[model samples]
Target: MLRSCCFRCFGRRNGDGLLWHMDLKPHASGDFSIAVVQANSSLEDQSQVFTSPSATYVGVYDGHGGPEASRFVNRHLFPYLHKFSKEQGGLSPDVIKKAFNATEEDFTRLVKRSMPVKPQIASVGSCCLVGAISDGELYVANLGDSRAVLGRRGFDGEKSLVAERLSTDHNVSCENVRKEVEALHPDDSHIVVYCRGVWRIKGIIQVSRSIGDVYLKKPEFHRDPVFQQYGNFVPMKRPVLTAEPSIVTRKLIPQDLFLIFASDGLWEHLSDEAAVQIVSKYPRAGIAKRLVAAALQEAAKKREVRYKDIKKIERGIRRHFHDDITVVVIYLDHHKSSSKPNHKQGTAGCITPPVDIFSYNSDEAVENSGDKIFPNEESRSRVAY
Candidate 1:
């Protein structure tokens, strides 16, 4: 019944920019479920999960500035992961690191190729978080603010679930991350700056590590036309930021009940403990959707608006409230023997298929008669939810 606990509402697909929460669906891992909710007019978050007999992989990619970096990672990261996975005859820490490095290296190549034609490409980047399970070990690697939290129960008559954060957040909002950036650039006192009540690198981007943002990582791209709002520009000899991910390895144990992997948007509204408690208390089926809904409600509360009113607002306009939220919850199977591996299931070599969750806003606009103008294609009459 846990796997069957999905939120269900029927609405056929359409070309409009709106997208409702996806109903929960299983991956190759029979125990896990994934769902996503898009809030941005142009969705910038991308995520995927793949399971094979030997391994399970989950990715949460959050794009900033634009969608190119996230989209590129969604298309290529897993393939590179699969390539190294097969080459090594299994998954390993080195393999995951290489996959990330290769993906970063490849995206830089893309930025170089496009910079001449589209100067804006230099600024786009994505925060990368990947979770891999193999050979009884769980490997979590992250480059940005996305997080992975484990819900664990004690085997020694413990009745409650405990939240264990697995991924390291690289956002400047964390004091340690700011220290890390400052350590990297000892000579540059202004490397990490505090501005508008938030810490940022050079008073610009918040995350200290990421996959793209060639403009910040590579000195050559900085001279090009950057976003005007992010002025006071200074060039550096070495990269201002990095693509290296902080990876942690743990032996997967039976006590581990489930894992919550989500973008920062969800965390902006919900804490790790709050999320784990929800999963522990609720049926597993549509929990990801539930988490997303919770985040939206929190966002609405902060804006002092009714949830129903927020729901009625269109995508582009919704940006002022919240961000694109993506969540994947994987419940570990207790019935299976913890000592054994799932080798018999075969290599889960297939990268989850790419999804076009983001739609560009069309130039055409709709006028609300005696009201505000909006997109006419957003026909509320046709959507059931």
Candidate 2:
């Protein structure tokens, strides 16, 4: 059975408010920490870690426009990964891409089914970042701006750790991403325009690749009524967004210390180097929460308010100060003896935070929202001991 990391159960509340976290947990390679803070009416960020004796999987889904896409991905993406990996005999770039494509296709089908009742579903989308580790190899895949960063020991016998980016952000805020979008849609003079003080695709969205955003991808869903609720919708001859993910794979070495997987919310206030430094300087336990706290402090500073005051702010109002932030820190135990077992022997399972931070009954919500694993599949995967 999948384990729900509810505050009332294995996890703990960071404070009396919207922050919740898992201080530390053991994975196949080593330990991991997870933390999340809500800033949206409904939490738009969903994340999880699945571990086994042979492999580990990590994902952070940062939703926009609505939480539906992220939540959907949080539920289905891993299972698809497991299914395809099993069929393909092992994990590979092709397997990861196939799983992504399958998830995108399935979500589009879901939107089609829900359109009659919920036309707004077409506009919801999520940034996806995934990291898989197997046999001392790491694979990072991403869409939109969520990031996976490696904190590695310095080269040339230096003592400090270095921050190495593992995923490419696909948001149009970057000049290169803007150029890529423009090159793809040269016919559309306004493919990307400066709006609301930042660059946005078609003046509506920022990310050029994501799991959802059907209205921008399918012409049939581009009518006025389809996007009437969301003004500033632009008509396009072709898809302005894609589900394709940029992927990177690397063989792990002793120099690789840890991995930081987080949504753009944390990256907005903290640089890759700063985040790695935090991880390098702090204790392993609660390190993810520490990162979240640091980012919140920076967010508060930007708004010229006290951190305590921001903590008192409610979710929707709090979003003005910061987006829903999620951070997962995975440590690689290179020092572990090679003869030792990869992971503790136990039933295979997964660990994920409560679906929504602000839910009145998080335990109940988590119980109802436990992940669905593929049928008859068994791999000794778990995040916590």
Candidate 3:
């Protein structure tokens, strides 16, 4: 049972305030499972989970900004998803989309309430990429640039990777983003010039979509007002205020082998085929840790960090890496049997209501069981071994 593999490796760098963490907890009925991975940057790449009984196989979250945002999401987001699913009935793509939006709203509200006086903290935000598997179906939701790619084993004994982008970036360079920004700052040519060519809003921020950044969602700033006048009502712009992720769903065929969820930091340095090749060579858990180690090693090598300079070693490591790197490799094995009836060979099943594996009373049993499963720092520190 893979049960989900999550490890956070920090590079030796100044201002490397990235965080990566994950959690995998069995459902109340002990039949299904949920997993989450959060990372602040590419250097702090995260990993996914593959559990047994094969109920609900995978769920992942890739985070950006500083470590706080990623850490906060890693701790809070999955719980909200569970709660939302319980209330909404099952984990359809629609249910997952609703949960993602609600979670982001709640997270933003919570951050605003907690940091009422600190305006700087309001600017801090992170990108999110999520994937959820329920009742043999896969649902993906994304915010920012982190990606989820599925690799399926083919009949000819070959494997091909299929990438389905679930979220849209909020950067001003996007056509829709450009149109929106132009509406706001019609008079500001510099903003348009900076955003158009470099794909940055103010010449610094690369991503247009993310969590947090309440400050950027304000009116009288950007180009057009963040809040638009809707007749007698003023409505907040979708990109600025809403974290509702774009959702995509697909049936899980037996040939589906694995998935890779990684931040842009890692993807920027490595291609999709190269990344999948690295993970496909190993088993699930081993591949997860190896991917993190490989990213760190690559960052270190690129920065030219000298092995002899003990004092500057961390600095060297950090110099080569400005952002956190998180990678999650989810190994999907369909050979195992599930409680559901099998479809004919080569034919994937149609999307139907998700099967309920747990009854109402199962919640009480889950609570009473009191099984805790997350790695402590000491255990995670040994990742290099």
Candidate 4:
């Protein structure tokens, strides 16, 4: 049923640019919508949604410096989650943490291995945010500033939904985050610095926790000749950024209407309440795309430009107005029967965008040139959704 539904409904691209969206699709607990708009020259943001009869996993990775780190996470994180969940017999906070750490370590090793040929991998990193639902329980794990927000009804018989943030932001812009970083390195007065009107760790990166950014985390990488070419390299006695995620777990109830998982691109322009209220008042179909449009509209308004004009600008130039945005809106359906198994039994069917959206414009083209476009078998299969 899930496969037939996906084949019939089909994911579609919007306009001529880098935007892609899936109107609506069924997951274990309910329905979900996904949308992504690329702004960077190479599309640094990567996202995926995996659904099955008993579980659903959502990931949004917002990359910086390069797309390699985010793409690596996209390729490795979920499998690691699945591997650990299977070995441990179930998903838990420890399982999720292990997945994150495993992915981070693997990426670090990749950077090390590729340094001889592609030394820039050391500078690439991404913010990872994951929302996983299993057996009526919800788990939110996050590193960096990407967010997951829960929309639920009020406790006193109220009809309106309340916005509750489920993940912690690790960006140094927050006072608490800066203090945490400073407290970790008391002797380094410049551990967190105010530069270019924003707080950054070592005046280099805003996120204090992430999967990569190996140059900031490894002293050996910091001393590498390749990293030194970036200018103003700050020496650190220890790793400044961490792969550890701030994890939160909760039991899903009927009152939990839906969840909005998005990158900082959407949050920078739209507030949590605004995003949740839009989903609450709008149609389920294309709600994720609608939220992205709302954020883009706000981004346009801030610059005194029309939304149409903003859409006209090419990828790299568009980054000046807004970063790459990825949104997944998961609606809870407590009344739905969970006993029915999915088409592949309990295995999740994955839905993900191509590594580079700018390269492919249509579903037909992507399907026709799957091997040329995706290159890797795992990548090709992942985008089949």
What lDDT score belongs to each candidate, Candidate 1 first? 0.73, 0.83, 0.47, 0.84
Instruction: Please list the residue runs of candidate 2 whose C-alpha ends up more than 4 Å from where it truly belongs after superposition.
Output: 1-10, 157-159, 224-233, 342-347, 360-364, 369-385
How do the residues 1-385 of candidate 4 rate in per-residue lDDT, one tens digit apiece?
3222211123688663678889998887778999888888777888888887788989999999888888789878888888899999999999999999999999999888878777777889999999999988899999999999999988886656799999999999999999999999999999888889998888888999998999888888878887677534667889999999999999998889999999999999999999999999999999999999999999999999999999888878989999999999999988763567656445557887766666554344543432231233343234421
Against the true structure, whose lDDT is highest? 4
Global local distance difference test of model 3:
0.47
Give residue 223's lDDT in candidate 3 (0 to 100): 31
Best by TM-score: 2
lDDT (Cα, tens digit) per residue for candidate 2, span 221-247: 767464565444567889999999999
**How close is every model to the real structure, measured as TM-score?**
0.83, 0.91, 0.62, 0.90
Clashes of each: 3, 4, 25, 0
How many residue pairs in model 2 have overlapping backbones?
A: 4
Give the poorly placed runs of model 1, Cα more than 4 Å off.
1-24, 27-29, 155-159, 225-233, 337-385
Q: Write the per-residue lDDT of candidate 3 for residues 1-385, one digit (tens) a residue.
A: 1212222222222211222222212321121112222221122222333332323423334444333454445544555666667778877666666666666677667655645343344455667777767677777777677777766655564545444344455556567877766676656554444644576654545666666554556433223222222111222343333365667788878767667776766665666666767766764434544565556556556667632232223321443353345555655555433433233222221110001111112223322221211113242233220
Cα lDDT of model 2 overall?
0.83
Q: 274-317, model 1: which lDDT tens digit per residue?
A: 99998888887667777877887899899999876776677668
Clashing pairs for model 2 are 51-381, 51-382, 52-380, 52-381
Give the Cα RMSD of candidate 2: 6.2
Q: What 10-residue stretch in candidate 3 is worst by lDDT?
A: 351-360
Q: Model 2: which ten-residue window has the lowest total lDDT?
A: 375-384
